[model samples]
Target: MKGKLLIFLIILILTTVPAIGADISGNVISESGKLAGLIVDLSKINGTESDENSITGVTYDFIPVASTVTGYEGEFVFENLDNGEYRVNVTYEGVTSGENIRLQDDTFVEFNLSGTIDGYVFKYNSTIDGVPVYLYDFYGIPAGNTTSGNNGTYSFGNIAAGKNYFVSAVYAEVSYTNNVTAPASSDFIVYDTTDKSDNIGVTIDHIVLSKDANSILVYEYIQFINNGDRVFFSPERTWLAIPTPRDISNFQTDVMECCLEREEDTAWIDPMIPLMPGETYSTEISYRFNPTSEPVFFNRITMYNTDYISILSEKINGLGLESTFSESNIVNVNDKEFEVLDFMNIPAGMTPDVKITGFVPSKNTGSDLGILLPLLLLLSAGALSYPFVRKKMLLKKKKVFTVKYNPDNPSGENGVPSGGNSEITALGINAENHTSGKTVEEMSFHELLAERNNLFESIMGLENEFNSGNVSEQEYMAQKKERRDSAVLVIKQLKDTATNLDLTQPVPELEEVIRHIDDIDILEKLFEREEKGMDRNEVKELIEDRIEDIERSE
Candidate 1:
């Protein structure tokens, strides 16, 4: 009896346990024909009964039951899977792909992975890592997204090939987009936002509003400064929003030194050029709007925080209007008091409203031809006399030579003198002995100045050639070394002459030359490695090091 009871208990335990069901197998291959050697997981999905308090149309994922690695042939298999629906997932190279599988019986599954899109995000010619990059299909559906790497490289996989898609990079609440097509392997693209505020610095120079006979003309001068170490290329391709206060017919968009586009009340400017570091881009825009016979209110919308703002009207008294600005000063212009607004340091992203109230001549008002005749005569006379006045002023001013022993002007003129329209002539040398040829010790002050100027000119020419890509780095360095040697010799001679003459304090003229020589010496050392030819990354690193050195010295 005991043996039979024990056997019955064992049979009952065996019957209660469930049995394994179907086996599922599949092979995963990328569109580029790359085999996937990754983990493939399977999760069993179970249906739940509807409850009164439960929410509807919600998906719940259960834990994965079994997982396996793909073989060399990109093949994966799961044995003893239950006869129910399961979620199959494959993860490879940090990318995940999945599908649904119903294992009613032993089945074979095949997955052809989609293509990939990969590229870099750049700002001011440098990579911006850790930025979020998104991918969307032609229908604007989010396909995939990824974050950039330290090198600013990002990739999105498992996207269908031969499809149109758009890529967007987001940084600092600004986005840049580009459209691309997925190739068999991958679609490579770049999204650059160098013209954005964070990458390019901006300042509002001034906003001037003047009265026109029939309407009011508004003028805005804004400056865009490039503070990045490298040049900000693609100026005209960069888009900046400018909101206009007037209607389409009343507004006029003028892009100076950049590209401009107007749509509705907003204007877009793309300064289509490479904006080098320390370079400034000035943009001017103007518009006109008609006024009413009754008191009319005019508002000049401040798109960006402006450093200086002003409003002037020649017919202020006639218009019977008072102009006011936030934190501004009053100044007299052509016998008329105009509001001048100046902000010493306006924080970025601040937009202040400017208000003006005046009674303008409406369509019902009669023409004041009697009052206008004298005004027209005065304007014509001023225009005709401008040239004579300018000439007299020019004649009275002394000729100023810019080629003093100073730093590089950054204007690409090198040491060449500018602005003075006077003829170039040889001046007297400051030496006690004015001989055509003399030793360094016997050289006069004027001779030293001339020699230093020539050296700087040569250096500047070499740099210009390099910048224009007309001269190779090797050639630039070779010529630079020769010029540097000559400059150093000239500087030493000047110092000795000062000491021999027993002069006290620093030499006023040679001070700038000495300082420039020191800077050149440091630059030579920094660029020594570049003589062998370095890539952009290496050059960027060198620049960073130089910046660090300068900061440390300060």
Candidate 2:
């Protein structure tokens, strides 16, 4: 009778209690119908808050409750979810969509995914058929390719929505490209092959020469100008033929590999895209060669009429040109000086000879007699005095020493073994010395602001130098990275210090700093800092606007 009564009581309790929670369901659908195996995130709305000064205005605080993947029918569910405000987010092919709702009982949500690209290829004004069309993502990754249909139409489906893409078509051996967004149409108008022109000439030929240990490195920046009324196209695709040394090594060009070809002593610039009339295009080439004689002679034929030519050589101890072609001038580049030789109005097919004199090999000190003689003498003297030095030390009385610790003078001023506060530490640095005069932890907020400002100025100056062609690409990139990294560290320190001081008001120093920051990465860091460090909504908005401006410019 007791067991039966207990069973009856348990059944009564189970029937009286309500269900655990409600159910949240959703589905993802695209043009293809339904997307299966898509991950859906369900987050409960913990709360909502507003920041009047923030660019985002009001923001929602979410607590992730559960996650599920869509089934074969692109449907997902969160069972036993308590009645409350919730959010459902689904991501497909790099595109994300979300929806929020207040769950009273069972709820359903739907997501529509759109990603389709379609376009047509045209020659002049008429649609062209059988032209090969290619699609590439914003990152230059080839997404798909197909030939245009009889109607000259092309279509790509199921690509990521809200993403940038590139559409290109090749016609008559020339490639035409255009940028497009998903769910949009892009049309390409290509021009047919034209006759080659003799009006193509070189506007500027700037050569920069620097020397390595035994080889001379050369960088050539050539600008080609088409003076014809029609596009300059050659049957062989040879736009310009540049003369190069026979023994040149590590030859490289800025153009595509297909646009450049080399034969014995000549590098051909065969650009696939024809040069438009009254337009100029710049090309860069670099190579290195070893000198075989005291005065090296560089003889090269000009393929086109050269308007102006300038050669700049690095200032080395034994490196100079034999004669100045025109008015020679010394120019400073990247804190180093270069000797410039200028010439103007050289006709085509003229072979200009440049003689480089004073080719002195760098001296090696490993076989120097002076260094070896002194080293041998010092060794001999140390060996001859070893016995006498040992005997005298043995006769001398030993002195014992002890270190005394003094709280008043802890740096060994009071006969204590110095803790090496002024000496090199294990990390190969002086404990009490720093290049910035104070350690990062010891720097004041104002000092950090000043440092950041200086770094910004340095970056700006570096960009100017790079733009002026005074700095090499490799060097400019390396220095820019290092300076930007330092600036980021300083900015982080400023953020932490500001937060600790509870800086809620606008600061002129910080505002000035933000106004000067052009780097997108640094601006982002400052944006994050504004959330917790200083409550400057205007500054945040300023940064946002600047970032947008930069993006547009790019």
Candidate 3:
């Protein structure tokens, strides 16, 4: 009876335990025939969940189970997988194909190979070797990357057929992009580099002065134009120096503190990027100082050959202003009247000066004569020294302005508070940080791209404000750096996520639907399909082209 019971227990244990012999088999083939020597990967689908908030809308967890190389007949298999869902992937060169299966029993899968792409990089009519080339799918996702060969030629294999892709080549820190279909050729044209500053000139030099209580705020806009054909590439980091008054205070510019080096009476600014030909680059500088007495003189020395230098100062009721420039007029800006001074064709190292005088106390105080009798008598007795006494009193009562950086509130015109307080909210240094309240790692590829474009527009708008002399240099530089840094972070994340995407999975047949559609509304719906597996460059391009053609035909 004991032997029989032990034998029965052993039989029950064997029956209850599940078998782990379910196999998954696959073959890699092309239109020609089955191909061999391909890397195949098998993964188990551990779980899956829906993510409505995600651009992909679905999340999958894959556990790598096994890997093998295809045999002579392009056959591969995983023999010991459990009875569960599995995926088979095969990659040859840069192309990938994959399929999923429910492995209740043995399963068989097949993969079709794709096409290839080749390109070249040229600079100054000559091919350049060792340039880095990047490949991006239609959805602006990075697919692969390689460097140019010794002959300046580059190629990528296994690209999906009948699909459009973008190829970007980076040479001398500049990137050139071209769109092409698979099984096609593309080339890049880049310019040679130069560090010569002879061709650089100031197209517009504008100065704006506004009265903030007793202090005078000065803003300078300098737009540099490159007239040369070659890009201005400075290995040692080029600098443009602007000479300011020696007594100026609160000096600031649209660059980091390290880049905007101040010494005695000169503010040196480093425009970060390489100045391309026919492009206009701008820099802004601002400072504040108290006028000590009548005929206060403001001086600035030009660093480049300036085409036009215009100085605009807000008109004070009792104060008179004069400029060394003979061309003067009165203009209205933003509902405020200003005294304008124009200096044209100023040579480098030439100085422009402005003088302010007639500093008389306002007589419209509405105070009774009895209250002002003592003050009038004292001012008459010291008429020659009245200006000095008034300046001294103004300095004594002047409030020290404290600049506070706030990422949320960036709408101030010139970062000056209207209230009679010492604190002012300046441009945010990390405005992008608070924009979406999401870190770069947490953002999806679509979100990252959108953020990148927004940051770019913000930077451009900041530069425009600086050029218009509407914003202080401190604010422009702070916000520009923050936005640029955020954009860089987002771009890096986008590249990483794009390169890691499962390109082996089948893309939806979006091209067919897009080709048959000619309405703008249909094109928009095509973009909405990005959440589905239909997101591809071919679909986007076809939709855009069709819409344009339809609009033209209409």
Candidate 4:
């Protein structure tokens, strides 16, 4: 009797349990594949008995403990539930038109949920991770979430086949670029696998919106495809500089009703709705971000308002909301992903700090290497390696005595060399090419002044002889003129030397009849005494005598 009772108990437990904890993957579709991310409200569904207290027209999934499933890429599933017969009413947020329909049971069923679909949850203008995704029915409420991976993919597990729901992809604690106030939109919707759908099959496509994303002012879409697949996954991601913050102010969506309220367009409604597979639609949420005047602040990431709505003119059901997406992804500055802990608020003054480094290029870091290395290296290597060969190359290759200096060639000593052919070769010592340039070692200013004194002396002698009447008037004038010219030339040279020595300082005047061979005027005036006895030689002698006297005094 004990054995029999035990067997009976085991059978009863087996028979009574509707879902064996095995994921019964179901699709919401018309003729397409899977329908993901649409909220099926328990109370409000069109064509299903929702106004009445009973959901009898549609399938009821009475799990020992009832649970909800979400869709991603047009796929959904309910896991870890002991299934039983429970009434389910499918309501997509704004989508209601579907061809195929399914009757509800506890097990996996493949029937028309509406239009078929494959869906994904892309962060609306974000590269952050670990954002929570939500789904909604015709009325606004939470549905399911897609756990986004590093690759920005999330999945909705088992779903009620005919349930129609709308999707809202949310990224928590995501950043907004500074000073940019525009709506960046990403989509999570129900999709169908058919020729008429936008996205289908395992590969679901989505546009990732970021802080710098410039979305069109009109609308942005989330596509769905119902391709008859089960629990297809997509990834999601978020980003933060600090530990994730709980400030939800940065993440808010405003809904505005269009003037045309004829259909599933209404106020206080999330535009996401009953997404058929292979069908694409977009809803506008006022995504204007208000910035703070804080410097180097942080963005606190979190999921908010999981429920949204889309209504009609009088009162019609379209889609709903859900939150089943996994909070596991987050994005950083490098766009690298890390596992997120939770949706919490991060504080300000937490941006990554990068030092403003003034790297004066070091010799090792490729700075002055261009100016210093190669020449030094070449010179050093030349001196160190093969010094003998280098010397040989210098002596032999530099043309030691290019033939021999031909003395027959007219030496340009007193006369300047005038023609290009004059220089065939150099004798004694030729100037060596110097990178530093040709510079005379030493030339004293005093030595140069001494040379000028001698010249002035000769001019003074000529002037003296002329003044003494030793030469005829014409002879005196001519002699004085020559001496004057000589004195002028010498004085000009002195002026040039003085200028080179920067001797332009103020000098006191001398009074005592000092004979100065300053210029032609000085010499001529001294000799123009109206005398014919004075000659050029006698005047020159006088100048020489005056010069000695002047030098002795100095």
Candidate 5:
């Protein structure tokens, strides 16, 4: 019984669910921004259109048309229908237009359309210029043509469709007069050009243009090439910038600078200049200016051609662009001496490019003198001077040429030695260095004592020189440390190996060891195979190892 009750309740709830539908609405308006009363007819194919008055707020609800639903006021819809293709035609009165579709099940569909028409009307005769011929519709869409200047050309753009329209024309009217008011009523003559025609060609609408008795037609224009002519100037792009006069009251024409603006970083590149077909660079001086009394000056500008002022909106600030004015430059790579002439600033309105040739160098003519008097100077100095100058240059080069020579001992072919070998060899040992004359290792105490004293005196001398600061810190430290180390070591060795305390020892002659260690030739050969730049640590290690090798040999 519980299972049967649950089944019955589920079926009842399913059947009782409410149905959902789509809502759509819209309005029909004219180009002139006015209310438009329209008739909206919704229909499926093979069915008659059911019409409704769309005059009130141009809105409507979705209503069923056959099995599908359609909007009532340019607004249409589908409520709860299965997916299928359906076409709709929008119409005001009998004039029907484009279509929309309902493509899926449970989908909402809405759409609208109107015909847009525009064209030009050329009158065969060319008597008057600047006349306006226009069309007005009760639906508020306005369009039509105007008179061509003496050439008999006129055009109308941005037209709209759907409704009755009346055409009229007015002669001697101002250009682009969209307001169709009193002048149009009196001077314009209306014509019945079209009634239901959706697409039509240009139609002639006649009108009159009246001038006040005291007024005369003022004509304004100046014609020239891309660059300015002699009479006008390229106007300044701005009124003023920094390093410029604030009031243009003292001058006549606008000043101008031409440049290309870049979007990123807000930067601009002047001389975004292009070379012309004649290999001449052309610039335009377009400025909007009133009539001025004083002649426009192109003193600040450089390019030569200046004519009557031409007006254009876009501009940049005081950037002077360089062109191929001449193939000469007084300023060299590092010349900073330059001055602005008093006549550089342009007046309030003038703009032009004046070409300047023959740059003048303000400095005395030493460079010219160099070229002209070269023979005389050479004769006086002669070839012998080359050697002296060369030697001086070489001396200068020696400072940086350090890898090739240690300045502390430029005379040496080798570096300093540890001197252990001198002490050992002098004791008459046959330590296999058979070249030297000494022969025995077992020396008498007197001989070793005399040698130890010699080494001590030499070390003392080196230490004294180090304290006096006569030598550089590097040289003094190296020499004093080497001597002190060798002296102490040899002194102990001589004491132990000696046979008598009373006997004198010979001086430890370290000249040969020092000479061998300072050998630059051997060093140059080693450095040839080594990397070009030896860092401090590497140099230190190399010297230390060489010293150890000489000491061990002793």
Candidate 6:
């Protein structure tokens, strides 16, 4: 009976206990820096409801749990409450920061309201005020708009923290957009100045030009320096715009120096290579254009804050070609001379013209004195030997010229074959003619570039012929292989010459061929074949024979 009574008392005591409760307290601060007198609302999230039309594709239902106002210190708190989910909301001047949270036990939370967004709008070197600045959410919905101040600065004090925004503005009839991230406090978020023609820090360092029979090629090296503390790049749109001449063809961009992406005429340098403060980026770009016999005028567009501009042409220096420039101050680059145009520091509100007049070198002149010295000596010798040559010609005409020696007929003469003299003479003439032509190493810069271009064209033509069924598979592969081999040799020679001359460029087609010219043994054989002056077909046959021998030996 006593044990039963004790069990009953234990059950009665358990029934008289109270349920556990929790509390949530936190401080609410304004991100706009207006700390005091801000409304802080705490509400219990009753349940979640899925609504496709909601801002975030979902909506929440809540009931008012507690409300308070921030003091001068921007602080607030809530007393004991049941352990459950709660929503925190802060509103000041129609701007709000609200989010849901779960309250368990004595939870402490710090609520950060909206933050301030301020930045400057720039067009090149000049700052433009009175321009309307618009802000958009990540969904592209319009958030707020304001006009820039007298100093070209605009601010939005109540921007939600931890959110991305698209900032846009219109100036000089062009619309510009930038992607920006709001910081996590009331601190000022300064967006980088929009890249303008004046604000582009990239300056043309030097330009190397080559004038050939059909086209003019340019190798341009440019440098980009970031002066501001912030990195220069645009996430939403292109920040750097590299302009090209009108009707430019065969344009190529090499980012091995400074990685960038090229889109036809414009090369986007920034984004791929963010120009950080106190850092500089350098890149080399190349392109070619065909000009008529008439003089062709070319202009390189310049941005603000230019340091120096230079143009060098071997043909111009060699042939003493007649060329003109807007500015004339000759300069030396890489130990090579160049006609330079000085802009030291382009003044603000001034767009100086960077025009260059170029033309094909005249055939009457030689590229160097070495070529002219031989011609002059020959002329002088010819003038002095005119009488002796006339007498010799008369004697030869009077003498009976008969085929006394024949190299082909060994039995026709006494010991010496008949026509042996004529055969010797023919061989001498052939040797002299062969020596007059330019070798691969002796070719001019223009000729070397032209040969490379021709090889590229030949490779493409071979591909076309095979694709159109104009050639058999065997013939196509044979010709393609031979042409590709020749291209490899030419490309290597060009690259070596360019390196010695400090002429850097991007040749993707040649790079591809070099990549596939795999075997070191094959490369050595090709070099030997080139030394022997073998034709493409002959070299191809040699390579085939080598491959077959290797296979058989294996």
Clashes of each: 4, 0, 1, 144, 63, 8
lDDT of each: 0.51, 0.62, 0.61, 0.29, 0.28, 0.49
- For model 1, state the Cα shift of residue 421 in Å: 50
The candidate maximizing lDDT is 2
Q: What would the per-residue lDDT of candidate 6 be over residues 1-554, giving only the tens digit for each residue?
A: 99999999999999998765776666665544547777888889776443333222224567998888887777777776887778777765654555456667777766555666677876546666788877655433356778777877887766566666656675533335565667521112233434442344644445555544545665565666676645465444445555555645555564433546556445665444345455566655666644443555555444334544444454343322222223343322223344433333322222334433555624332222122222222222222112111111210111111234434675443322244223222100110001115666886544565565555545554565567688899998897787688668777776655434311111221232332332446545554543232122323343455445444434
Ranking by TM-score, best first? 3, 2, 1, 6, 5, 4
- What is the Å distance of residue 328 in model 6 from its true position? 3.4
- Tens-place lDDT per residue, model 5, 319-344, is 12222211111111111211111111
lDDT of 5: 0.28
lDDT of prediction 2: 0.62
Clashing pairs in 6: 124-198, 124-199, 125-198, 405-418, 405-419, 405-420, 406-418, 406-419
Assess every candidate by TM-score: 0.30, 0.39, 0.46, 0.16, 0.17, 0.29
Candidate 2: clashing residue pairs, number: 0
Ranking by lDDT: 2, 3, 1, 6, 4, 5
TM value for model 1: 0.30
What would the per-residue lDDT of candidate 4 be over residues 407-434, giving only the tens digit for each residue? 5544233222222222223222221211
lDDT of 6: 0.49
Using TM-score as the yardstick, the better of models 1 and 4 is: 1
Highest TM-score scorer:
3
The residue pairs found clashing in candidate 1 are 235-271, 236-270, 236-271, 236-272
Kindly list the per-residue Cα lDDT of model 2 for residues 445-517, writing each as its tens digit: 6667656655554665567668879889999999899989988998888776654432232242344445434
- What digit string (tens of lDDT, one per residue) describes model 1 on residues 260-351? 77776567787654455666676556665455644555544434433333333334433333432233333332234544433322323333
The model with the greater lDDT, 4 or 5, is 4
**Which scores greater on lDDT, model 5 or model 6?**
6
Superposing all C-alpha atoms, what RMSD in Å does each candidate have to the true structure? 26.9, 26.1, 20.7, 48.9, 43.4, 28.2
lDDT of 1 at 209: 56
